[model samples]
Target: MHVYSRRKRKAGVSDRGARVGKIERTTYALGWRIHTVATQGGLPLTYRVRQANVNDEIPTLKLLIEAVRLLHRAGLSIKLLIADAQYYWKDFFKLSRWLGIKPVIPARPQIKKTLINLRVKHGFIVEGDPELIRQYHRG
Candidate 1:
């Protein structure tokens, strides 16, 4: 699940239950955050909507599990998962590994640096080849 925001700029909008949240410094919006799970082909599989103030990670595990179950029933296998930095957490990584899915998310900057340093100290490859990394990012 990845989170995306939509602006609700109209005043006195009714019944949509949009909430006001700060999206950046000196900017605020009334809207919802969309959590979407999509295929590598850019086809949307499932989605959930929640208030903008809600955290993206909250629904991620549940969404992944749901997608896995649905795919399994249809005889499909989940081979790789590509997501943005917002989904880069240790638990998320563990979950994907446990499910036999290769997670292709770039870690947050500090985490990335730490990981690279550790890899160098342990004599492991710091990063994949540029072409392979680029392909994953494109997805």
Candidate 2:
């Protein structure tokens, strides 16, 4: 997210959460990071805005937990969860499985070759591409 520094601040105020992060190789901007857990139709279930430099896993875990709890109260369970390769944390995925969610996170190239073809919904699944997953798990 790009934030235009348009507003003037108070005399003794500090830029608390505002931060600078690289937008591109040669470009940079001061802005916050937005983390959201939403449905397939793009309806946001939970969200958080934090400093750009903050680790995504922190708020991501919080958002997922919040969403899951809400859904559980409504008697619904998440069957499939699609996330970025950057979210491939062992402990995180373990917690997701304990909650009975099927997480589909792409394996990074560096670890793809080392990963086994486990079909467990609790652990990492190597096939992230929809086409590849479909090809292997034919219906």
Candidate 3:
């Protein structure tokens, strides 16, 4: 978010922390990168604020690791992590699986259409994750 202040320098905005990044979808402004992890019910679980110019994928890995650490320490487990397309990365998927969580992120917009086509050609789609399949059978 771009904070508009009349002052020559905003408080606490260092040369490294705050930089030029996109805001309002059409404008690039100086601000911090804000990333959030939320629940399926739209509740925020954790977040990170970093330099605005940082790449979208960098802080996400840290967020996921931190989330796993905090949740597991509290006697909870993350079965699935649903993120947006920007979070689609092979290494991220591998790390999430290693952490015992399934990453449900689309690689591209066409993935939805492809999956739909598969379901149309075949009556049902098979579940690849063993844990999810077992849960389906148990229910």
Candidate 4:
């Protein structure tokens, strides 16, 4: 069977552009995106790859649509898809549901209300390290 492949790439400065701590790389970074399809019985069928300096949401949606089209032609259309939350957006859910495919993705933790409200609702819970001296003093 003939399989199709597509590629896209994006480049940008790394958040940690050359420094210590969380920012440790003072350099450019390239992000990648890859999508693949296999038979209903789990056999390798086709694949594509794309890279982007930005986010994966839009690219992933585009690639998924193309893959669905190809799979339909091959009689192996996708049904249930498991993916990361990075690709979880309103449009992604809309398109996949429209295609009759169920997507299982965890909600992004950053959007958790309890976590977001911690500092504001009740001052941050700052815990101080316990030193051996403190334990000895208590004893």
Candidate 5:
């Protein structure tokens, strides 16, 4: 499981003339971090664990590469990778492509914005673009 971050409001003493107290903002962080890869049958083949302070993308990429190597040695090759947005990045996608593995990852908020811009530039709806749709769906 992955940890999610959320913003919270805290009560604080009022500083201005208003009767309502100031709202202090607080953010919560996940306590543990873990990345895993498994076979299509749901048999875990790789595991990477780190502290909460570690970023998810880097370790996940490393773990994937290692899994690929292990599978290759065992006369097996992966065809697809499924991951969350936290582990999604351009480099990861490129690496997966180079290794002949299709990656299925959700676009980050910024990536979604970029896609919107691309759609406008081409003057075509995303649904009408076969290649774009394939990439978006398969990637």
Candidate 6:
């Protein structure tokens, strides 16, 4: 399962669960953020609703843990996990690796630069195998 965010804007203060927060630079809204975990085919596996101020990563780990547990109980296994760069924190990668899920996320800019530099310092080819490089670049 993978998580994605949806912005739900409220029209009035009577919208009990929504909160006011910046959605983007210089823009603010009263809303709830819907974080959902879904199958690769687009079926929702589970979801969480939180005030708009909540960051995606905060609930993502919890959502993944729950999804993994549910899948395990059904005798299923997750092969790969695909998520946006927002979910590219090192701890998340480590946890997914520990759980045997191949993460298919593109590194954030700073991390990408660090990885490139590390590869160069280690004398490893930056784009060694054409096909493998292609797949990595796909994310």
Q: TM-scores, in order shown?
A: 0.73, 0.70, 0.63, 0.49, 0.59, 0.69
List per-prediction Cα lDDT, in the order shown.
Answer: 0.68, 0.66, 0.63, 0.48, 0.60, 0.66
- Give the alpha carbon lDDT tens digit for every residue of 37-89 in model 2: 88766788888888766777788888888999988899987776766557777
Question: Least lDDT summed over 10 consecutive residues: which range in candidate 5?
Answer: 15-24
Evaluate residue 16 in candidate 3 and report its C-alpha lDDT on the 0 to 100 scale: 51
What is candidate 1's lDDT per residue for 1-139, written digit by digit as tens?
Answer: 2234454367644445677755664876767767778888878777788887777778888888888888899999789887765587788878888889887775554564432112211332335456546645578
Q: What lDDT does model 6 reach?
A: 0.66
Winner on TM-score between 3 and 4 is: 3
Where model 2 places Cα greater than 4 Å from the true spot, the runs are 1-16, 23-27, 112-139
Ranking by lDDT: 1, 2, 6, 3, 5, 4
Name the candidate, 3 or 6, with the larger lDDT value: 6
Question: Which regions of candidate 1 are displaced past 4 Å?
Answer: 1-16, 22-26, 112-132
What is the number of backbone collisions in each predicted candidate, taken in the order shown? 0, 0, 0, 9, 0, 0
Clash count (model 2, backbone only) = 0
Model 3 poorest 10 in a row by lDDT: 114-123
Tens digit per residue, CA lDDT, model 4, 58-127: 4567767777888789786787655544465668878888999865543454544321111111232212
Greater-lDDT candidate between 2 and 5: 2
Residue pairs whose backbone atoms clash in candidate 5:
none
Model 5, 50-86: lDDT tens digits are 5555656768778888999999999999987765445
Which regions in candidate 4 have their CA more than 4 angstroms from the true location? 1-48, 112-139
Distance (Å) between predicted and true CA of 120, model 1? Answer: 18
Residue pair clashes in candidate 4: 8-51, 9-51, 10-51, 10-52, 10-53, 17-26, 18-25, 18-26, 33-50
Structure candidate 1, residue pairs in collision: none
| Model 6: CA > 4 A from native | 1-12, 24-26, 112-139
Question: Candidate 6, residues 36-137: lDDT per residue as tens digits?
Answer: 878887787878988887888788888888889889999997777766556767788787888898776655444544311112113323333354345445
Cα misplacement distance, residue 117 of candidate 1 (Å): 9.9
Backbone clashes counted, model 6 = 0
Sort the predicted structures by TM-score, highest score first: 1, 2, 6, 3, 5, 4
